[model samples]
Target: MISLKNITKKYGDKTVFHNFNLDIEENEITVILGESGSGKTTLLNMIARLTDFSGEISGAGQVSMVFQRDRLVPHLTVRENILLINENADVKRMLESVGLSKAENLYPKELSAGMARRVAIIRAFSHPAPLLLMDEPLVNLDLSLKFSLLEKIKELQSTTGKTVIMVSHDVKEAAYFSGRIIVLKSGGEVILDKKRVSEKTLTETLLNGQSI
Candidate 1:
């Protein structure tokens, strides 16, 4: 399990989060929803150990992430990029898992935005990380592609049982994809907390974090 206590972050005198506390089940997927500047990305960063903080944090797992921006190696083939992390059989299994088994030889520039995003996701999941974090992973994909990829993501998670934390601007998507939804209001207050509700209810619904 992951434990966060009194987690607070500030830039100079402006506090982004104050005394925030959260616990994430070790193998369960946790989806975080918030508007822009709501500090969702900041929270993900802190969880990934990419940012410093004052609150205590603890976990027993390897972590990897797919950021809002693709961090592909421009000069490397898709396979090579993923192999950079796995360096073994783990790469082949992950590629097949993400539906990218045929695009192994392609370079980043040769692929579309959605394709690149899939490659990044595969790369992150190929490692030994027990926790995976994603930030707006489907932002550039068309609806059909997004739907397809989301399934692929879910399949990978179900297969691996790795903990997932995704930060997304689309609450509907968050509700549909995650088992638990955490809504962070401005100033880091968790105004909404809901547990697995039927996805049909969140199709056009604006969840206020009280459903949980």
Candidate 2:
């Protein structure tokens, strides 16, 4: 398990989280659900130690992250970019998993948005990290692609049994991928923490702004 004790994060005078705390279970998929600026991403950053905060975070292993943006290197091919993180990574298998086998030698600029996103995800998952953090990774894609990637994510987690913490505002996504859901209101307070429910129920709760 990963525990955060009295975490306080601020950007100058603007505080994102004030003495907040959370515990993330190992080998489970936890979704941080919230609107923009609700500090969901901030919390993930703190967990990944990508940002500085005043608190104690323990029991987290090395983390691999997929950002909201596809941050693939422009100069390198998909396989090369993935190899940059893990030389022992099975580039061919990862590419095939995402249906990008033909694009292995393609650079970031050569791939479409969805393909680039797949490459970014493959790169993150290929890295040998016990904890994986994703920040609204399905934001801009169409519904079909979104669900495809969602299934792929679930498959990866089931196969690897890695701890996954994903932050997203989509209720359907939270319901689909989360074993546990932490719903945050503004300023990083978790208004609801509950086990997963049916997609219809989850959608209603989110639509009505009701906390479980």
Candidate 3:
């Protein structure tokens, strides 16, 4: 399990989290939902130790992150990028899993957005991290492609048994996972937490601004 105790984060005078605490189960997909300034990304960064905050975070060892953007190297091919993370990474096998076998030697510029995103996913999973943090990784995709990537992520999580923490704004996307779901308000307050909640109920709860 991951334990976050009294997490206090601030940017200048604006406090994002004040004595906040949350425990996340290990080897499970946990989707965090919130508005723009609800500290969703901040939380992930804290867990990844990418940002500074006054907190005690444990069990987040060797985290790999997929940011809002793909953040791939423009000069590198899809195969090279994944290999950069793990020298022994099965480049062809990983690409084949995501139907990118033909694009192995293709640079980021030559690949479509979805393909680049898939490569990023493969890179993160190929890393030997037990904790995976994804920040809005599914944004700005068509419904079909978005769901397709979601299924791929689910498969990776199941196969790898990594503790996955994903930040998402879409209710449908959060509901897509069978693991735990956490909803946060602007000040980092958890308004709702559940497992395998229906999409309709989640939408209604978000709209009503009520805790469940």
Highest-TM-score candidate? 3
Over 4 Å off, model 1 = 198-212
TM-score to native of every candidate shown: 0.90, 0.95, 0.98
How does each model score on lDDT?
A: 0.81, 0.89, 0.92
For lDDT, candidate 1 versus 3, the one ahead is: 3
Q: What is candidate 3's lDDT per residue for 1-212, written digit by digit as tens?
A: 99999999999999999999999999899999988899999999999888999979988878998999999999988888888889999999999999998999999999998888889988999999999999999899889999999999999999999999999999999999967999998888989989999898888878876787
Q: Candidate 3 vs. truth: CA RMSD?
A: 0.9
* TM-score: the better of candidates 1 and 3: 3
lDDT of 2 by residue, 15-113 (tens): 999999899999888998888888999988888888899999998869999999999989999989999999999999989999998998999999999
lDDT of 3 at 71: 92
Instruction: List CA RMSD, all candidates.
Output: 2.4, 1.4, 0.9
- lDDT for each residue of candidate 1 in 91-182, tens digit (9 for 90 to 100): 66667766777888899999889889989988888878899999988886898888888888888889888899888877557766758887
The positional error of residue 162 in candidate 1, measured at the CA in angstroms, is 0.2
Candidates sorted by TM-score, best first: 3, 2, 1
